[model samples]
Each structure stands twice: as structure tokens, then as C-alpha cells.
Target: MTAPTPDTASLTSWVGDAVLAPSVHNAQPWLFRYERASGTLTLRADPARTMPHADPSGRGLHLGCGAALFNLRVAAADEGWEARVAARPDPADPALLARVSFVPGPDRDTLADLRPAVPRRHTSREPFGDEPVEEALLDGLRGAALAEGARLDFADDWRVRELLSALWDAGHAEELAPEVRAEIARWTAGVDDTATEGIPSYALGPRRYDGRAPVRDFPGAQRERDTAAVYESRPCLAVLGTHRDRPEDWLLAGQAMQRVLLQATLDGLSTSLSSQALEWPELRWLVRDPRSETAYPQIVIRVGYGPEIPATPRRPVDSVLTVE
Candidate 1:
């Protein structure tokens, strides 16, 4: 018997799932095109959505698109299609981030397990409980990153403090810069529900009343009295890194990140991510531990059991995907 393959409808649904992957400031800077004749899906970066101030090198853009690629793979696996991805297949077309060709394989079940998490995984910005993540669960997260060609290192108390300080310093520095502030303003939709892309005010969680939680404070975020919540004092911070810093490395780190995030979700944990310190080259270098083999720190993640937060807005799949 011949096995089934995805049609245009299946590809469209998968692209919808792909866009759900989180992007910096919810900018959602990615595009997808499926070639029917070749049975290949191509991922591209949207130049109009690039963040010039925060992600000048396009590292964050690559990471976001990589995450979307991971989700697309998971979605395809759920439909029994094995996705083989080639990153930066064309040197001449740098914006063409990845090309994925699918085949039938037995391993589809493994990646398909994560399909349910695709919709449930949202960036929780509210305060988390004091419950410590179990060692076994942390170990699984470490393995998830490793499978995707990246590293996840849980910071010790002293290192967590250092990361906190770096985040604070970077946040203050970004606030002071007009260009950075302008970029934030452009991506954050304060109370505008009609906007398709950008961080909605409702998803901002709350203004951190106290504690060292790494929630970003978008300018003009709604600050009602009820919106101010106290965050966990001793937050569990982890640094996701790679051995080298390059566009391909960034993409790998992003896939690792989404894999970790999905696994953590399954473990019944809430999570949030911050790249404040990583936005600046000077601060980024300080994020990695001296003893760790991680050569470049890509993103900082906060994990715990926190209150349920709303999912941010994403552009319609039709707007971002082209079927040929």
C-alpha cells in the first residue's frame, strides 16, 4: 500500500502551527513557501519585520525562524511526514534561511508527540511559584537541547545573580537609547487588538512589582493596580548556547530552544524567555559561565510553575505562507 502525503491543506495547517512559535517582541519575522512539484518547503526571513536595533545582526531573526521550522517539522511528523531540513542551502540567497524536504519514516511518532504542545506553549510572564523544577525534568530538558545541536545550562545561584544584574543593566541601557525605544514602540501594540503582528498589551503579563524575574518591561505597557504582581525571588535561569556564533548556529540554537520549551511544557512547567543581555555584544559575552563549554549564549530562559498567560498574536497563515 502507498503511504499518504500532505496536500495543500496539510501544508497550510502546518504553517499555521509554525507561526505559533514565539519570536522576539512577537515580531513574527518569518515567511514560508511550499513547492508542490519538488515536495519541499522553504523558509525565508521577512526583511520588513527585522528589528534593526535589537537584532541588528539578524541572529534573533534566524533564531525565531528556526523555531518556526522546528514547529513545522513537528506538525509534519504528526501527519506522518519526515522532515529533512537543510539550513542556508543557498549562499547567494542569505534571506533563504532553510529548505525542508519530507519523506516517510518510522521516527515520525517521536516528533509527533510534541504536536499537542504547539498550541499550548506560550510565553508566561506572570509570577511563578516557588516550586523547584525536579532534577529529572531538568535533565530531560538538557537532553532535548543536545538533540537539537545546542546546550542548556542551568545557572547556579551566583550565576543567576550575575544574569539578573546583566538583564537589569541591559534593560536600563535599552531604555536610555532612543533607537531601541523606537523599535520597542514599533513592535509593541499597546491596547490595539486589531494588529496582527506585535506584542499585545494583554499578553504583557504584569509590571514586576518586585523580585528578580526577567520579564521585559515594554514601554507604555498597561499598568493598572491589579496588573502589578510580585514575581518569584529566586528564579531558575538557564542559558541556551552553542559552541560557535554564526547564522547557522543561531538557527540551531532556536530549534533547541523550541524543543526545550515544548518538553518543559509537557513536564507541566511554565516558562518565559529574555534576550535583554544578549542584545548587546558586551553583555552577551558575560552570560556564559567561565567553566562551561558553551562558546556563545543565545537566550536566557526562566522556568517554573506560573499562572497561565495569554498567547500573543500571530499573522494569519495565508498572509505568511505561499503554496506553489
Candidate 2:
């Protein structure tokens, strides 16, 4: 069924689709409020969803909400409406992440095609095929990030590889700390049916000893069996960054991330993200390209052709949306 045409109902439907956007550890850290009288949709971050230990400054929260905002825009376009978005419009209210107003515009089916991938796009932690991504497809993904005010840097040099590895080493070291481990444990719910969010045991991949590469192990604490198999080599790594390292910059990066991911989905690519390296302050600077000026790295996205993985579960729409 199509989304309702009335602004309120339409936005409600759009928000439902938007929530399907990925978040760190499936936190789903967002709230949507639709003003029927004004026809404005406001996206807010739920402070409770903030990962205080891993994401102390709420940067990841902004990224997650920003991804949801991007999906909302695409969903709006698919429904034949223009999404006029303002990121962090009010300085006084930090939680007011973005405001989207619907306007009549030319019909664009590009986003309509993306609608199908919204449900299909997933974080595939399994091994990808050795087949490299086409240069043209990579260009499309780059352009998608640029359009959202973010830059995509493909790591190809040995120095860059060393830097990323060093950062990952440092970040992983930090994660191993007793205090940090306790904090993460608090947020990460054990295999319980009542839990609505956080990474589940089923999503965890295997731990392989490949000195050249590393993958985040979600079920490391629970000793769950790894359902994912290993590929021959690591997939192409692309880092998303912004000129500035502010809250607004992070929001932009999040939107760009989802755009690139959805575009990858359209190109029949499987993807996963590795932000563990960028989570730590000391290691964050290491992830940035030395040649590129001071741009903060937001995420490390791994992309390549591979088998479609299972989608993660999300909370119901009624749980995240407020009608008033």
C-alpha cells in the first residue's frame, strides 16, 4: 500500500520507513514529531539511546538520526514530494536534529527505486566475493556522499592501511578496559526476548586471525557460534569524513553514509561498517588521511559484492513516533 497523501499521515508513513535505517548497535536513537498544521516533520535524538561510554559526545547518536533523516527524504521523494531539510536548525535546542518540510516538486523515480532497497539493505558482516566493485559504481557512491556534504576517501595506500590498523588496535585496547567493558555490557542486553535493541547473538560474525584486517565481534561476551563465513580477502574500505568535526558535521556524515549504503544496495553490493577505530579520540586522528586537512573521519564502510544477509529487527513505529 502507498503512503497516505495527507501531510500528517504521509509523514507518519515516511517516518515508519525511515526508522528502518541502520544505527550503531541497533540503538534506533531517534524520535519523529509531525506537525499537521504546519506540515513540518522534526527529527530528534532520544538522549536515552545515547551510548555514553562508546559515544560520550553523542556523535554516533547524531549519525544514526541523520541516517534516519536521509531515509525520510528518500521516502518523501518516492511519494512525489520534495524534502526541504534544515540540519540542526536551532542552536538553542541541540536535540532538534533536523526539520523537513514537504513541498511539491517534479516527480523523481530515482528515490522510488531506492524504496525497495530500504528493507533489503543490511549490515552484512559475512565474507564478500573477491570481485572488486566497479569503478563506475564507486564513483556513484562517492557522488552520493558528496551530495550530502561529506567526502568519501577510498584507502589504497600502505601508509593509510597502517594508520587504520593502528587506530583499530588502540580502540580495541580501550574497549578491553574493565570500566569500558562494564559500560558496554550495561547497554548490550544478553540474549533475552524482551530486549528490543542492541546487537543480537545471531548478527555476530566469526573471529579470524587475519593480521591485515579486523572485524567487530558483537557476541564476543556470550561465546555465540559465528554464523558468517570468511572470504578470501578484505573488501574495499571507504572512509566518510567531513571538513569540520562538529555535531552538524556528524549529522551530515550519517546522512551521507546511508545514501552511499542505499546506492550500494541498488548496485547489488553487500556492506558492513567498522567504526570501532574511529570511536576513540586518540585513534580517530590516525584514521584521517594525513594529506587531507583536518577532516574528521566519521565511519569506515566496507563494501563489495556478496550474499544478502539477514536483516536486523527494529522496534515498532508506534514506539518511536509521537502523533502530537
Q: Largest TM-score belongs to which candidate? A: 1
Tell me how candidate 2 scores on lDDT: 0.77
Report clash pairs, candidate 1: none
lDDT of 2 by residue, 247-270 (tens): 888888999999999999988998
Scored against the true structure, residue 100 in model 1 reaches a CA lDDT of 88
Go through the candidates in order and give each one's C-alpha lDDT: 0.88, 0.77
Error of 2 at 68 (Å): 0.3
Clashes of 1: 0
In candidate 2, what residue range of length 10 has the lowest lDDT sum? 219-228
Give TM-scores for every candidate, taking all chains together and pairing residue i with residue i. Answer: 0.96, 0.90
| Cα distance off (Å), candidate 2, residue 114 | 2.0
Worst 10 residues of 1 by lDDT: 219-228
- Looking at model 2, the pairs that clash are none
Evaluated at residue 16, the lDDT of candidate 2 is: 83
Candidate 1 local lDDT, 216-298, one digit each (tens)? 88875663334677888889999999999989889999999999999999888998999989999989888988877788999
